[model samples]
Target: MSWLRALKATARSGLTVERRRLEPLVAARAALGLALVVGATLALFGPGAAISSAFGAFQAAIATFQRSWRPRPTLALASGASLAVSTFLGYVTGAGTHPGPFLALLAVWTFLSGLAWAAGPTIGIIASSNVAMMLVTVTLPTSVAAAAGHAAMIAVGGVVQAALVVLLPVRRWGAQRDALADALAAEADYARRLRQDPVAPFDPVPLMTARSAAAVTPRQARSRPAELHGARGLAERIRPVLASLADPAVGAPAEGPQRDRVRELLAAAASVLDAAAHAIRHGEPVDLPPGAVAALRTPDTVAILDGPPRRAAVRLAALLDDVVETAEPRTETRTPTPTETRTQTPTAAGAQTRTQTASQSQSQPKSRARPTLLRLAPVVAARMRAELRPDSPVFRHAVRVTAVTTAGYVLGSALPLGHGYWAPMASVMVMRPDFSQTYSRSVARFGGTLVGVALATAVVEVADPGVYASASLAVACAFGMYLLMRTGYAVSQVCVAAYVVFLLGMGGSAWTQTVYERVVLTLLGGVLAMLAYAVYPAWETPRLRGRLADWLVTDGRYAASVVAHYANPAGHVCADVREALLDTRAARIAWQEALDRATHEPVRHRGLSRAAADDAGHALAQFGRVAMLMEAHLPERGAPPVPAAATLAEALRRSTERGGKAVRERRVPEWDELRETVANSGPLMTDPLLRKGAGLLLDALDDLSESLAPPTDRA
Candidate 1:
């Protein structure tokens, strides 16, 4: 990509407006904290303290809005505390006259803030906000005593926000409920789609979001509603089952009695799942469609579909029963068992299916137990330390940020501008670890600063508002920003820039700097951030092959794990399958993220061409789907073992691991051993579905090898 095209793409992204549902109540609540802090500080201390304290509340509110799994109040409190610390330390260093010590401290602090990206997106966002806030607030305090007083006021701001959040909550656990509900609703939609087109693609995004929401802190764990527990995993299980039942190659003939029965079951499952989703989302009584329920329970379904299709229907019905039984709203009490809640006759396999489903979905709280907020510190620390290596993008980003911020500070100070810190603040706010975000935010911030400064300056010239009026304008700007945070980054920046201008006006300073001065400094800072990335860049293109390799390794392990279960169901830990699935999902997400980031980078594919990448990705996706299908039809306890699968599973594990290494080494990946195992077990394979799925998986792998082959060899 050329610079012009990159700029165009990023600008378009930054300026694009999204139509998100505005949360007026939540916005008002956040704005009220800012209003309270500003009002109290103005009445008690003065405009300076009011301005200093408003930042704390504004930043705390922003932290609460970040994409984090931690409690919102906790996020607010932590953000407030970090801002206070940064402000106090900045005050301590700036008290000296030389400006050398402060610059050194600024560089070091900014570097650590950048390194915080290693922890995760949430921490990185909060840390950058803290850095930007510090740049503005540090210039507020004049002395050591003033620093203490201002810091205390900021802490008070945080306390006020958290208190308001706890006291007057807006739909408590709302995000979690929506996430889980969305996942179930998506599965219901997928079931309905399978009726029309059996090979319809199912998106994992909703299930991924649900899994993220289901990860609760220990404090949350104790108070979370019973219905939200393990339901995400159950939703995960439903997709493959629906697909297996629909696909003609696995479940039934293309057109016959079995196919018709399969369509009826699909429609019924959709109705039931939809009812369950609504009940869970709204805490309302379930209204299951009687016709759909009857279709699922009809004995003819069992008679028409035998083997895999029969098992899928029985399992689907059992899973649906558990979904409603778990998600059904009740008074604050422990949920009743299936037997306790309702009475029904067990089919030939429904009893075993229900028992197995309950043990897998209801018994387990989540896929894995996540640590509490207290335990998260060490985990985050470990992640940061792991990224300390030179090759890590987080490390490179830290270096770039440190250099850019310091350079901005020095250059801004060198010019005759009074508020030199504005340059570095703008840079810190806009920079990210990728080409797209860094450029997009830089463009957004600079453009917003221009419009904001001009608008605020115009207001000051025309109305000549007093201290109270200026503060009111600042608060209004903040309210607008909070309400529209989801619209776009550029939209939020306009409010932020205007808010800053009004805040400065509120301080009652005789304005020496004009609108152009502010715009120029901010533009310079943005330029510095973008230029620094050009000089010291971390390109995602080089990592594409490695990411693909990682995906292959994890996908291979998952297939082997599922295949191994068929060989010996009793010895298989269900948790292993769950773990392998999660690992593969994570790996796939990583690869896709890398690919997305690489699109904006101005570089060649390096080792993996675009065509090769697409082919390899498709192959791996098909490989994963095959495993999912196998997982859906796993054998019951005490069933006859498919001994042939053990040999195939071992071969798969060995060969795929080697294949991943070969890909990383820029060699064509081979599945010769896996093919040999399949050939050797020609007559021994008891499960024809397994044999057929294996053939499809191998065909995909062969396509991958051909795509990755040398150009000459391919011809």
Candidate 2:
């Protein structure tokens, strides 16, 4: 009986996991199948080609509807309106081959079928791509029998694909949750190690946190809706999961050795949430306390909290050990070593002293708010205009990128290779400025195509003579592709390939036996795309370096502004102060990422470019730390404590205009006096009310100027 219970438990767990994994794929399949079936069924009642063409017209209508709802919808009624008109035009152009009036009628229905809100743009793009292909089929004659056969096939295919998708939906949110948890755990471990030693030479905590946080932001944003709306209503279910974190009972640690560890983990998670919230609210970066690293590394600490958990336990344990190891100082236990053991008193003391000095050196501490007048737009816009003028290097670079890629594509399309098909695709694949992004797209394309082809082949084998089976297969393929759309390249390739293959088979192709030819064509397209990417790669370093520089420059300016305002009285002080503080925070994060990418390959990005990116990132982060200190002291924006702050601000502004390197060198006017006044203003910052307004700025000015200094080539 005990054994039987164990078996039951195992079976239940296995089934749950399997179901979770397959849900998203199932949903995609179902959507694809449904769309295909509807189109194919319409074909059975008319000439198969005419019905297919009409369905294409419907797709175009949907696409138009989608594009109409962007950046605030205008006078346009729906995307489908354009599709209907286009279909009519196509029909008119081929009136000698097919009745122009029938084509016009087909256009109206297509338009009506595509009126979905929010999804029109994406659907419209898909629709437009196929519209031309479908219009070509207008040459074929139409009748009730052909349309009926087409419609029936489409309906069947849609049903089957939709069934599959609904039955085996993919677990996108679950994956996101897992990723989020891992990122948090890694950062926590790093912090914990930092805590143990407090003084050992340590890796900067903010850098790792920034990277992890970066990854989490995009995933979290993407997963939010899916979690709210996905299959089994998992999204709805996860709402409570996110809420449960707020509940003291859910995230709080039970008392024991692991209690502290647990609290740290919870704090880390909270930090992530806070960072995400701040980014959304004020568009600023969230920086965690270095101590959070220790808590993340402890396995016993991480294992207790388990909701939508995957690998959280193992990661937690490893993180804890790592923290303990990295932060802990090395001590030499000199056991009485034979003859040499007795003479160690003075030497041991000296070694101990040296170790203490090294440890102290390592623990050095490294390193918000509200809305403002929307009226800063003119001032900001002017600044933007000056900064973004076309004569600058930035505009020149942008134009160059556009021209190169456009030229590459035109050349490819014009070439004879792969019947002029491989060239255009090649141009897109090869000429992308971002190699990684381009590669990812290419991989997705190939994989998606393969999966599509396989599915199409299966449907063809099962499809019977006449139009019903053909239409059904086509519908099924469409639904499947739609459902598996998010997972990456493979899913995309599978659906598209399958749908096209099914369409070919349904149209009664003698080429059904020549499957290899289709495969070769796709391969050829992928190869060309890869080649285009390799020939003239646009390295991501230059843009990344520029962003880093911009962030630092902006941060320094914001710091000075906040300080100046604190030194003087102003209206809308809180509003103004918060705006400056938040701006600093935001620029800091942008700087860090740019720094990381710029420094990722030192060999590839050398000399001035490398130094510029690195110095800028560090400077911004340091400047941010200063701003945080200021904000902490001055909660209010309007109070002025120190009169000298305004003078200091003027000096800093001049230095900033000269650039960070100059500012770091103390080259600005009245630099020494400003520094002295800010340093001496500490006592004034301690007053409760005055501290909230004026003291903050003084602290910020002093800290920021120092933090933005560049690193040396010290051994």
Candidate 3:
């Protein structure tokens, strides 16, 4: 009964459809790409050639949908090359005289391909496509020469799709625009929170998600997309400032006209950000609201809103300036700096300055050199080496994929079903790194296959699609699949199942028998995938402690950097601090994902209790809020109370190290020294804002300490 209930729930979730505003555009692109490939292939090579071309077109269309842009030519070529290799290999195995060697070859290929998941989603898709192609090849009856011809035709299809992508680019700035829009919307929400309850904890998810989405690739970083990159950078810089202004402890002036001005400034800033987001999304000139500019230039606005809000308002004005600059067309060049300028001076300092200037000019070209693969090879190698550890998630996932996929292949071969390849193919598609994702995908695959096969069967019986109609159906299904791929697994699966049915029908398979075989084999494959995990699951709970410790270490370093900046505001922002913040975000994201995975695992395998995990999560979030506040203070230029700031910095750093140790060693951290440091800080600390910020940090540390305490020790 429990199993039945679970199954019912899974099916219901799988069937739920999510509609996105961009679905129509996505559907249109998919349909057009598929239609072009199918129509061209049929005209040139007839129905038989259309089969191989269709597969190629399918691969290319999916690639476009994955990134929504034409990949760099080199990457596109590499992808096409991979597809060709896989198609050829599949063809060879299918044409071989003996079944034993083919089966052995397939097992090895599946195992090796499974490792591609470690690289990322794109590579993983390529690997899976290879396996799927092999399954298709085995079903076709053809000679070696015919197989080679088909492979060539398939490669051409991929090339055609790539060409289409290059010629018809869609939504070039879509991802970046969406990211900025989300950030703006989040700022509005944050402002509302400040108005309603300044003390309420801010959710960092939206800011982080948008920033991650807006992150540029190395290639893009080198290119001259200044406006997009500049806007993204400004958005990141503005986030911490916004967070600081929303701090409840820093209240508005009680009885001053400046208080109302400050409120007006906040509203104005929010409006400007919203307008900028709209402009970026719509590709129009940014038109600031009428009162927004006036609010920034108001006589007493800066003086009255002194402290974080004042600093934030000033920065917000600078950001608006940047947005206006970005909206304008660039048509002028700046004068180049002179390499050498002779100045009459009798002192040694003059000659030294000249020498330094000459050396800097000589080195400028070297510094501006573009990155090459040779230079990046060492970094990539080192990262791969680090992830090669047996304890690493990527390594473990790779091993799991190999073992399960091999088992799936063996099971499929042993089955008496006519189309046994479907079983292993289904398994290959469903297996993922985490338990929840794998289970959900498995359920979705099963339910979706049922729906797809049923729909395809009814269509075949009622319409009896001939060659042209089958091709048309294939194009339609391909479009639908790509459109819904990100929406939900089950919804996407429905399209996939329908597409396969049309494809097989074109190959002259009996419709009823084909649907039956696919349904049974799909169910068998899903069961195999689920059972593989059940037998030796990689539960996330056991790994939570390590993940938490990593976050503590990274975040602690970031806090230390922030403290250093506070002590010496004249110094430029430290690159290490920026990198540390990024690392902290990564670590936090990983921990959250692990916690989510643990939630879905059985009680026996969930190492931490739910209450304990929730408490830790809350503590971590508070820590993030404090870190953002400290970061917000980074741009302040006035001299700080050096001794006091340094003392607080040291205490905060030491607290982080202790917290990391406690999590790692399963012991309570000693917070006595930190508490003492915070409590004994002198009245010489003149900056009220700094004092308040330090108090916030101390409170966060205390909360974290309490959360980490053993259950027996907690009140």
Candidate 4:
């Protein structure tokens, strides 16, 4: 993509409004918290205290909206305490006569905040919001004692919000319910999609998201709802089963009675899933769809499906029963099985892999909401350290932000704006790790700043509002922003920008000067952010090939592991294949996310063209689909092993390792060794299903190689 095209696409995204279910209760709670903080602080310590402390309220409220599995009160309290430290530090540094210390502080603060992306988006948002708060808060206090008092009040605001959350809770455990229900709902939709496009590509993001939401803090573990656990693994298992049942190559011939019966079962499965999803989401009794349930259990369909399709129908019915049982509330949780108790790893796409119930997850506190912050410290530190490499996108983001802020501050000082720091503040506040977000945020901030400045100036000029009135107005804007959280980026920015304008007006920034300065400096900061990103962008385009290579490597391990298990069923453990399946899924997800990000970057697709990307993605999807299909029909525990599978498995591992290296070296990936091994093993293979699946795998890999080849070489 060119710069012009990228900007145009981004403009559409920035302004696009989504229609989603409004969380009026959560929004009202946030607004009420802000109002209480502002009113009490203004009454006791005047408007200055109100201005500084409301940031705590604001930050805490935004924290509540983050996609974290931690309790809302915990998030609120953490945001407040962190922002307090930042406020206190900013005030202490700004108290000095020299600007050098504060500038240095700003550099270090923004850099760390930028690097916080390594910990995940939730942590990054909280960290960057703190830095933005510090930049603004430092300018509020006049003396050291005043700064301490203000910082104390800021902490008070966070405490107030947390208390309100505990006292007047709204939809408690809503996030967990929504995440789990949504994952099931997504699978239901996928089942429906596969009825038509049997081999359709499915994104496992929702499953991944539900797994994240399943993490409960130790405090929550004792009291958490029973339904949140147990069924997630069922959702994971159902996806591949649905794909295998629908695929003509695996289940039934095209345009036959078996195929039509498969379609009916698929449709029925979707309906049943949607019903289960609704029950789980709302904590209600399972309202099984009568017709769909009848179809699933019907004697005719079960009698009609034979071989793999028949087995799939039977397995599907069994899984659905388990899903319904888990979705409903139980009198007492069932005892964890030995396998579930001993393992924390969720099974990948395999019929033999049993699920780890949500109730079982409590045993693994490391994956939970960081059971104790102290316990999670080392994990977070390790993640941050891992990103400290030159080519790491997270590290590059930190460097970009540090340089952008420093440049903005220098330019702000040379300019005559009264609020020189707002330039750097705006720059750092809008910057993100990727091209789309960084550009979209810059556009939103500038547009929002314009509307905010104009509106603030007009209102002050017309009404000449007093201190209390200005604070009240600022609180109102905060509420609007919180309410409009899901609407669009530009819309929220409009409220945030207006909120800041009103707060500054209350602090006695001259209306005319504040208006013009804010308008000009906001545009300047946005431009600076854009230019900095362009100069040192973390482009995702070149990384596409490497991501693909990773997927190929993991896929090879998975298929080889499965084949090897068949070769020596006595020697290999099911855990090996299960672990390999999980690796393959993770690699697949990384490649998909990287491809999505690369699509938005304004650069050439280095080592991969657009057509090749599409074909490569499809080929890889098919490769995994073949493995999933094979997994659906694994031999019994003590069945006679296929001797030829050993040679084919070894060849698969070696060929794919070579192919991955070829990808990294910018050459076409070939699976000739595996192809030859499969051809020779064809006559030796007794199982027709396994033989045909191997052939499908060969065709998929050969297509992948051709797609990855240079255009001239292909000709």
Off by over 4 Å in 2: 1-37, 44-433, 458-466, 510-518, 534-537, 568-573, 577-603, 608-619, 635-640, 660-715
Cα lDDT tens digits, model 2, 556-648, are 576667566557644222455555644554655555544553333212543234554444345445445444334323322244456655655
Candidate 4, 587-700: lDDT as tens digits:
988888888878888999877988898899888888888988887667656778888888888888898889999998998877767878888998998777778888988888
Top candidate when judged by TM-score against the true structure: 1
lDDT of each: 0.84, 0.38, 0.65, 0.80
Candidate numbers, best lDDT first, in rank order? 1, 4, 3, 2
Clashes of 3: 0
Q: What is the C-alpha lDDT profile of model 1 across 1-715, one tens digit per residue?
A: 7778878998888788899989989999999999999998999899999988999999999888887767889989998998999999988986235578888888888988898998888999999989889888888888899998888888778888999899989988888888899999999999999998987777787898888888877678888887777677778888889999998878877798899989998998899888888978887767787777677766686668888898887778777877877787766654443233333445657677767876766466553456765788898888888889889999999999999988998888889977888889989999999989999899888888887777888888888889999899999999999999999888888888889888888897643464666788899999999999999899999999889889988988898888888888752237788899889999998998899888888888887888878878887888888888888887776778889988888888898889989988999999988898888885787888778877877777787788888778884
Off by over 4 Å in 4: 331-371, 568-573
Please give the distance, in angstroms, between residue 144's alpha carbon in candidate 4 and its true position after superposition.
1.9
For each candidate, what TM-score against the reference? 0.96, 0.49, 0.86, 0.92
* Most accurate candidate by lDDT: 1
TM-score quality measure for candidate 3: 0.86
Task: For residue 502, give model 3's deviation from the true position in Å.
Answer: 1.2
Residue 321 lDDT (model 2): 26
Error of 3 at 348 (Å): 36
